[model samples]
Target: MIDVLYFAWVRERIGIPRETVTSEAATVMDLVDELRAREERYALAFADLSSLRVALDQELTEFDTPLEGVREVAFFPPMTGG
Candidate 1:
């Protein structure tokens, strides 16, 4: 199982802060496809991948990044610098 965390509007849209997912996805994008197929809320939250940022094990990564042995994945909106 992989820990999936949603932050900011991602959490708001999905109505949850985090979840444990048992998946067969080999990449982050594949995992997204699974989630998007689960419900409308997930689809909406992940509709525009360009508007989102992802992290693998707390380190920023691309959606195509491999999920092998990954324990955590986080999704959030892009951060703004002040």
Candidate 2:
């Protein structure tokens, strides 16, 4: 199982903070496809991935990054320095 964490507006749209899921996805993009297919909430939350950033095991990674050996993943809006 992987720990999926949603931050900022991703959580607001999805209405959840985090979840643990078992998936057959091999990469972050694959996982995204799965989530996008789950329901409207997921689809809406992931609709514009370009505005989002991802992390794997707490380290920033690309959407195509493999999920192998990854225990955690986080999704959030692009952070801006104030």
Candidate 3:
């Protein structure tokens, strides 16, 4: 199982801060596909991948990043300086 964390609006949309997911996805995009398939809330939260940033094991990564042995995956909107 992998810990999946959602932040900001993503969390609000999904109605949860985090979850444990059992997945066979090889890449972040693959994992997203699985989540998006689970419910409409997930689909809405992940609707625009371009507006989102991802982190694997607390290190920023791309959607194509491999998920092998990763213990955590976090999704949030792109950060901006105030």
Candidate 4:
């Protein structure tokens, strides 16, 4: 199972802070397809991949990142901090 965390507006659309998901997804994009298929909230939350950033096991990653042996996956809007 992978711990999927939703931050910022992504959490608002999904109505949850995090969830543990068991998936056979080959890549992060595949996982998004699975989640987006599960409900409308996910569809809205992941509507624009361009506006989102992802992390694998806490290190920043891309959508094509593989899921094999992944322990965590976090999704959030691009951070802008000073």
Give the best candidate by TM-score. 1
Clashes of each: 0, 0, 0, 0
The lDDT for every candidate, in the order shown, is: 0.99, 0.96, 0.98, 0.96
Query: Relative to the unseen true structure, what is the C-alpha lDDT of residue 39 in candidate 3, on a scale of 0 to 100?
Result: 98
Kindly list the per-residue Cα lDDT of model 3 for residues 16-76, writing each as its tens digit.
Answer: 9999999999999999999999999999999999999999999999999999999999999
RMSD, model 4, all Cα superposed? Answer: 0.7
Each candidate structure's TM-score, on Cα atoms with residue i matched to residue i, is 0.99, 0.98, 0.98, 0.97
Candidate 3, pairs of clashing residues: none
Residues 1-82, model 1: lDDT tens digits: 9999999999999999999999999999999999999999999999999999999999999999999999999999999999
For residue 47, model 1's alpha carbon misses the true position, in angstroms, by: 0.4
Give the clashing residue pairs of candidate 2, or none: none
Residue pairs in steric clash, candidate 4? none
Which portions of model 1 show Cα errors greater than 4 Å?
none
User: Candidate 4, residue 11: CA error in Å?
Assistant: 0.4
- Give the lDDT of residue 63 in candidate 4: 100
List candidate 4 stretches off by more than 4 Å.
none
Arrange candidates by TM-score, descending.
1, 3, 2, 4
Tens digits of per-residue lDDT, candidate 2, 14-82, equal 899999989999999999999999999999999999999999999999999999999999999999998
Report the Cα lDDT for candidate 3: 0.98
